[model samples]
Target: MVNDMDNIAGTLQQSLIQIITSVLTVIGVFILMLTISWKLTIIALVTIPLSILVVAFVAPTSQRLFGRQQAALGKINDQVEETYAAHTIVRTFNKEEDEEKEFNRRNHQYYQSAWKAQFFSSLMMPMMIFIRNVGYLVVAVVGAIQVIHGQITLGNVQAFLQYTNQFSQPIAQIANLSNTIQQTIASAERIFEVLDEPEMDDKIKETPVLAGKNLPKVEFKDIQFSYTDEPLIQDFNLKAPRDKMVAIVGPTSAGKTTIINLLERFYDPQGGHVYLDGQDIGSMTRDDLRKHIAIVLQDTWLFTGTIFENIKYGNENASDEEVYHAAKMARADAFIRELPDGYQTVPDESASNISQGQRQLLTIARAFLADPEILILDEATSSVDTRTEVLIQEAMNALQQERTSFVVAHRLSTIRKADQIVVVNHGKIIETGNHESLMNQKGFYAALYNSQFAGN
Candidate 1:
């Protein structure tokens, strides 16, 4: 599988050049051989179909074997990735030998399938050579009889022999690349599948929403969306005016994140529209729309780069002082300074170099540097302790002071001060009000809040 990917870069280059040059050579030589002797030309032409029949018979078996080999390789890769990610757990449980045995089993399966694919494909070239050799024998016997009758000159027979070799040469080359052709066909199939997929339609992109507004009110009007057979959001509606913190509290898979996906245009509603400043969001360039919004999700994504670079990523033009101030606001500056190179330290891809709480802090700091007009905090403080969450809440309050914000929280305590708290159950809104109003009403929000404080 590694070899397949390594060769992917050059597969088209070598195969195309070989096929084109070979085809052109065959065409030129074919006409010349015909003029030498129709009898000999017919013999060469017969070999063409015979060569094709050989490939047609052998190539499918090779392709099937290749597919099996790839699947086996994928399984081995999955096992290796799992072992690598959980190497510490394996050592803790003393399961390293067991893991090695499973890995060896998958490796052996891959070896068997890979050899079979190669062995079947390898038979094509030898069969092609045999076909051409038989054509050689036929040409020699027939040309000799014709030469004896002086029907064609000795030079013509000699030239025809040369033509015969040339005619079969391309066929031989193509046959030798049967395995490559099969792999190319398989790769092309997968690529075409993606290319043929449905894409977003933007008929209104010519005219944008929010032409002059840096910040616009967001609205979901009669929204209907679904991922599976049933609709997740049926007749959903909401209006979030500018400079207000709207908190959405719900149980797991209550469509909290799905709402975020719609706001960011990751998935368009199956029906109805999401509007910004009274205009449909579909009317704006998605990139232009997203530039005004900043999101800090629960899963903090930190790439392999310096801390300074990661902070600067939210706004490349941000001044060094701006990055420091943002970090301070998010309360990430203290731990960052404790690092060896501070802002210059490079983290691993998984960001395992830092604790999960620190990773969340850096992400929040990065979002602060963006200074966007709209903000999304999707369980942004979930990884932190209660004390740290309280600290981050202060930073979030400062960030949301003059921007429209949406906060999805599982912990009921985080949204106590929000201007409006929305309670979601299943796929629909169950309650909507402030912390005071919802508590006064004694509804779902009150129940949820009471459950949190029950022990106390």
Candidate 2:
């Protein structure tokens, strides 16, 4: 909220400064016109209201066009970003021509709107000049008649022409000012759209601090969730015992990751309750809940930093020895030692400096350094080669002992040794038992297992 207020205030201040400067400039021009001649001043004043009417008539249309142009440009930028980020995938799928066509369509829309805005804004200056010229003609004719009748001197006629030019100057300036003001307003509206969005509300009203020594059990009771109007989990229930490894296995789109999301309180369940230890999760502060849980995902993201700094992100105050120990346990220490600078090796942006397997190892090391009581491994080994997968599984086995762990995996070998395996299909738990028992039952789990190892 403080950030939002600051942004809004800054924008308003900038807009106001520009408006005031433009107004003062116009006022200065008006004063200069008054010094030329009274008759010419009156004639120039007539064009002031006319210019205002013209601007008022054209400003809205130009602003609307400009706003649309900006929005179209944003879409084009999004398309470009996505294409560049997924260049490899685009090439693999032979989607270059399709993507190019889409980009051209969006670019054309932007060009059209931009051209319209410029066209309207460009008309303002010419219209102002035309009106000023008409006023010039009128002043010259009237002043000549007055000079012949001895109502005004030759110098006065000359002065009237000068005042006409001065008055017309403000009209031209007003046109430019109108365009700028409209654009500023359009930009402000876009900025406010983001600032006005509601942030995640603190669920726990009271500040409840949990000690980092011992962790609590997690429970999901009759939990129902949905991304859209359609339901995902109708009535799901699960309990994760304290300091125990529990693995959840399911087919694709079985709400496996959704469970992890709920456990982390990224989104509240539409119906039912989630409890941590004995307290309802909603009753615990978000920070308190997250402090106890650490997750290592298959797609690891590492910022541009040294390997040491990346691991230190998990626990900023951790000593160097602690970081090394965690890395050694995750089997990442050997790789780090091989690097030119060991732990000091700087990772490229997006961690392109290392291979996929190495990146995953580094992330596992990060999670280990944090030493959370609860850990989540979401397809953590799915992206690596068979050799790396074996190494990560060994590290995972060491980490899971005496810790409440949730493992989601597609490989049957990874979960075959789990203490308990729950098979999920279409967001519902269809079977729950050890691997051997589930195979014996010959149900969904048995079928899935058979399909996975059919050719083996």
lDDT of 2: 0.83
Worst 10-residue lDDT window, candidate 1: 207-216
User: Candidate 2 lDDT, tens digit per residue, 10-101?
Assistant: 64787567656666766776677576566657876787788888888889998888677677877887888899999999999999999999
lDDT of 1: 0.85
Q: Which ten residues in a row have the lowest lDDT in candidate 2?
A: 206-215
In model 1, the clashing pairs are: none
The local lDDT score (0 to 100) that residue 180 gets in candidate 2 is 62
Model 2 residue 385 lDDT? Answer: 91
Candidate 1 per-residue C-alpha lDDT over 220-271 given as tens digits, one digit per residue, 9 for 90 to 100: 8788889998879888888787899999998888899999999999988888
**What's the count of clashing pairs in each model shown?**
0, 0
lDDT (0-100) at residue 177 of candidate 2? 64
